[model samples]
Target: MGEFLMDKVDLDDVLDKFGVFDRYHAVSGIFLVLGMAWNAMWYFNFIFVTEKVEYRCADHLLPNNTSANASTTLWCANPAVCSEWVYDNPDSFVAEFQLACQEWKRTLIGGVQSFGLMLGSFIIGALSDRFGRKTLIVITGVTGAALGLAKSFSTSYWLYFALEFLEAGFGDVTSPLFTLAVEMVATKSRVTYATICNVGFSGGLLVVLIAWLVPYWRHFQRVLYAPGLLFIVYIHVIDESPRWLLSQGKKEEAVHIIRKAANQNKLNIEENLIDMISCEKDEGLSFFTVLGNTLKSKSLLKRFIVCSVCLIACTFASHGLIINSVSLSGNKYTNFALSFGLKLPSSILSGYIIAKFNRRSPLILFFMACAALCIGQPFIPKSKYLLWLLILTYMAGKLTASMCLNTALIYTFELFPTKTRSSMHALCLAISKIGSITATQTPLMMAYWSGLPTAMFGGVALVAGLATLLVPDTGNKNLPNTVCEAEALEYSDRIKK
Candidate 1:
């Protein structure tokens, strides 16, 4: 009787009967998927506004003997000092602040936003796991939207930077929303669900369109962030995750959601069986205790460490490639768009490969392919004929790296258990911040050697890929809800409590 209390016993068992893709799931999914896309853009929207733009000293004299002011259309990158500057994109943060010589400050913009994301995920994600994903999602969602919208009106760069930090640290919903999105679907569709959430012309690609449609930074931000204001209404619309309810020992709430879902799906659930659900909340285990258990297990701990290495490498490669894409010989806007825009296809292919094949093999192959292309990029001769080759090779690197990054994300989701899944995912993301921060300085690395950043991306990716063999494969496995279940992931390591 204790073991058969509906979801408390086995959520998948109940979810199987309730119907994973019924009307209830479909309605809830639309809101959650959109939520995922919205959350994706806010983190990197700074990329478009702070992108490197054409600028030259504003105090200089033009060839016609006319003094250059902010309105001067002519530009030159002379190696001379000046008090003022002219930027091609007057609305860009780079242009508005005259960061022509103070390039480090411009780079700091990305660093600050990445830091906010890292800190927010580590701190707020834990809070969500403890309280509830739904509550935290609404609070963070509203707060994030407000801060981001306020940033559009800021005149001072420092004020803008502060707003960026505040918005990201308080508003990051990826971790919570990610778990929620995946949990709403069944295990068989988890990969497909993850793929669609990102590949559906999500944040990176959308920003390109938004930036093109409204080239000015302030106005663009207003247009981009205003829709996020609707997140406040999610409190009434989005349902609390059923798995989270069961984990917290809220049997009644879980039953309620299940019953509602069943009725919506036109399925019949035995009310008497639901009434028989009598059990404690997994003995009221604290999050730390369960997490500690995973760390204690030799199998789980080994996997965690290896997964961290892979994630760090993935972020480094992904960020470095996209940030450096604009410098390639082509239209800057087109290059930037292709850098992320092409992920739509690569994501679909990666999802299929990882699903049809095993997770480990495709990861190894993708990372190796990306590493080879990136490492070879600098060797391409600088010439009109080979410029196409250079861009093609670079874009290829971006494509494979994107695929590898996606694989790393889904792989991490499978390796951990539900007891501390979000917490663990947040930790991995937080740990990977080192790569993101380092990636910001890639543009600066070109001074020492044009190929230094590219080579660096390849080297790290190479090592991470080779190391993937050390971690166990989790293809076509059920989502584990306990440390014991996670330890039993591989048959050889399975232990009976």
Candidate 2:
């Protein structure tokens, strides 16, 4: 009888013993998708900057009213007038541009605001682990939407900057969505489902494409307003993650949330099922202790450096193409369309292909392609056809790097312990922003010196290629659950061989 029972208990049987019932609640899934979609608006910030800055600066190059025919002359207004005067007086234009740049440097360094968002993610993730996922989701959604709306209407630069920080801080509600969704679902389906955010992120690029087609800043603002407001309404219907509650030893609340989910799916959960179970204990350390632990973790430190290097490289390459979409000299719309167009299919293919192949292979190949593009870009002369070809190459490189970004996130999250995972991930995000800030400023400065953008993008691609070698392959193996476990893998045959 004992032998027969041992044969009957396979891994599948074990999982089924602990699996969730009524897994397909329509309301819960919809709310999750909507909330994630709302969080995707940050990707659209590139589009916002492109349109707003372009609209403000386009007439800066135009001839003044005094120089043109009276009938043809149109008196400039607001930003348009300030641009005209600056353009007409060549000597003073640089000073004015410098002043404007100084005044709004923080806005340009928008990636710096990512630090605050990381703080919020750390705080909210702990709160979710302690309190409830559903509560934080609703609170974060409403708060983020309110802040986003306030940012849209802020009257002063400092006020607007403050609100932007608030928006970043609260909008991180989606950061925990991965952990939450994976925990709530059955283990078998969790891998594929949690990764749906990759496709959603690509879909967000399409959103930016459509949003960019809006000619002015105000019209674009009006369009984004709806998504922000809608998110708050949808948060009410989502259920909390039962896995989180169970981990925190809140068995009753876990069972309550699970039963509610089951009820919504028209199934019944056993009342005493949760009471019959036991789970491993979690220390639930404070944020500072987590940070200290992460700093002391040699393997985590190595992985963090790898991620940071790749992030800086990827940001430099991707934004080299993204930042130029609003400039006066190039075909802005065509450039944006081509870059964003490549990203959608590229991102989807990456997720699918990476699942089947060794992770390092794709990254290495993409970075090499980027390197080749950089070496060849300088030779291509400035013409519409050549420009389009360059744009296409740039898009291809960005698509590949974007895939690396997705893979890095998955890799980093798995490489750390649960206690310090959020903080470590947040630090990596902040580091990645430093890369983006450099990318934002580098091309404009390069263009000022050389009067060529092709060279700038090419140089960026080269740097990104060098960074690829620093990233470790994180595929086909189980991630270590503790610092000690992770340290053992460092000298494993995979690396030694």
- Every model's TM-score: 0.89, 0.75
lDDT of 1 by residue, 1-497 (tens): 65544443456656666444578877877777788778767766877788877665646657754454443333334445556666777868887776765678888988888888788877776777788788888888888888988999988889988998889789887778777877766677778777776564355577778888998888888888888888889898888877777778888897898788888888887786664443335544455675587678888878878888888888898888888887877777798888877678888999999989869889999999989999999999989988889989998988998898889988887888776887888778877877888898889999899999998999999999998987767787788877777777765333411
In candidate 2, which residue ranges exceed 4 Å CA deviation?
1-30, 49-136, 181-191, 206-216, 233-235, 252-278, 328-331, 449-473, 476-480, 488-497
What are the per-model numbers of colliding residue pairs?
Answer: 1, 0
Off by over 4 Å in 1: 1-9, 18-21, 64-81, 200-203, 270-294, 491-497
lDDT of 2 by residue, 397-469 (tens): 5566566566555655555654455456656665666556665555446536443554555565566556556
Deviation (Å) of 353 in candidate 2: 1.9
Which 10-residue window in model 1 sums to the lowest lDDT? 70-79
